[model samples]
Target: MSDATKLLAEKRTEFGKGAARKIRRAGNIPAVMYGHGTAPVHISLPGHDTFQALKHTNALLTIVIDGDEQLALAKDVQRDPIKPVIEHVDLVVVRKGEKVTVDVSVHLEGEAAPETLVTLDHNTLQLEALATNIPDNVVVSVEGLQAGTQILAGAVQLPEGSTLVTDPEALVVNVTQAISEEALEAELAEAEAEAGIEHEVAGEEAGEAAAGEAAAEGEPAEGASESSES
Candidate 1:
């Protein structure tokens, strides 16, 4: 985990949407701090500082409220749908030695064996780690892995003091033989034939429309000529 980011916040006495809007208009975001079996605290945090602090996943924060410091982690953040602004935040109170479950991203490193395709079955892993020691990401190596090779969640090496909360037998990375272009095309054609489906061709539709117009014009001209002769 990264070092705790320090932020100064003010206790908010106002409630409701109007009050929250007013708080945001003043360049602060409304937040709620809860957990550890205490009453929830409503506060306002600086917009810029809070935004920067939350850039890190499972960021440990040291919130200074009324000169008293409390350690917390950013559990949830609400943002504007079309704007780059944070509307609200939820902070969960934590202690120094407490264990917390968090999802860590799985990063792939190295290359797989030649002529093989590598697929990631799981992109994140649930892990339990100390509140102040959460890992940024877990690395998985596919170095020279051949076809039919699979890496399970249990086979991954994690940071010290971290325990996997995900199922051990879950597949993480899989290596498979690459399919040739000819085989792929043939498979697609076979699927289309089995489905008994046909796609409309734009050029064919245009030609049929032109032919119908010509036949209609010819009938109209013959009728006019016959009426003139009569």
Candidate 2:
């Protein structure tokens, strides 16, 4: 996986929100690289290049800082939820043989048995793998599986040299018979009623507390007035 992604880098000369906005206006995204017991280094990367690279999850980066090259992984990326703009990215430096923990999405490859609904209980699995050799996604087959069947985390085969960091007994895929509409509605109503009852009880307790405080102050003033009259 030695596909080197080239990015035009620029040094961030200023700090704070104003500086970040200025960087974005110049078609660049502010990024900070930190890891391996080093102070965070702030920099700017070409907006288009950063966006394109991040489109691939677990993107490997060859960052050039002041003519020095470093291998990094995109640890975090902030983006506009509805737009194509990049905000800020957090990168972690990595060595060739270093192992890192990451989460990979679970992908179902085959269909379940007839009339059995395949439910994905876990969408992703945690894995500890070499930095440069991370798997894109974990694929699991449910071909011809019947109802009441389950696939555990450990049962899903991982790529060679990759170790599972998630709990072995964690349920990944579950095949269950579909519930009827009546049962679903009944459960929903019961949950809502339980929540409403709890809220009402809390409100009553708060009201009682306020009333008690008011009564205490009123009694103190009444006692003072009676003593003055006497």
Candidate 3:
């Protein structure tokens, strides 16, 4: 566990959307801190500092509010849909030595056997570790894995002091033989046949347009003959 990042926060005296907007205008983000049977604390944090601190998954923060410090973890964060600005945040207070359950990223390293495709069934793993010692991610090696091989959750090696909270039998990674080009083309053709009504309609419409153009072209010659006779 790395040391918790320190952040300075100010207690929010006003509530409502207007106050929050004011805080944002002042280059701060509104946030709420709760957990451990304590009353929820509403505060404002520095926008740049808060954004940088949250870049790490399961980031532990030491927030200084009113000269008092509390350790916390970022539980939820709200952001602008179009902008990269943090709108709001929810923090959960945590204590040293306490075990917290969180989902850690699973990273794949190395390649499987040639002509095999490696599929990650689970991208994250639920784990229980000390609040201050959570790992950023777990790396799983697929080197030389053969087709039909599966790596289960229990088979993954976790960082020391971390325990798996997800089901042990859950499939994490699967290695399978890659489909040949011929097989892929065949499957695509089959799918097209299954949904061929639209294509057929389009083809028929094109054919009718061609036939109509031919008929229109032939009608001019017929009209010329009828006019000469008249």
Number of the top lDDT candidate: 3
- What does the lDDT come to for candidate 2? 0.87
In model 3, which residue pairs have backbone atoms overlapping below 3 Å?
none
Candidate 1 per-residue lDDT, tens place, 170-215, comes to 9999999999899999999899989997777697676667667767
Over all chains combined, what TM-score does candidate 1 have?
0.83
In order, candidate lDDTs are 0.92, 0.87, 0.93
**Model 2, span 1-230: residue lDDT tens:** 44758676777779999999999999999999999999899999998888988888787898998888888999988998998898999999999889999898999988887777898999999999998888888999999898999999989999887999999999999999777789888998899898884434586676677667767887542222344655
Task: Pick the winner on TM-score between candidates 1 and 2.
Answer: 1
Q: Which has the higher TM-score value, candidate number 2 or candidate number 3?
A: 3
Badly placed stretches (over 4 Å) of model 2 are: 179-230
Per-candidate TM equals 0.83, 0.76, 0.83
Residue 177, model 1: Cα distance from true site in angstroms:
1.8
RMSD of each: 6.4, 13.6, 5.7
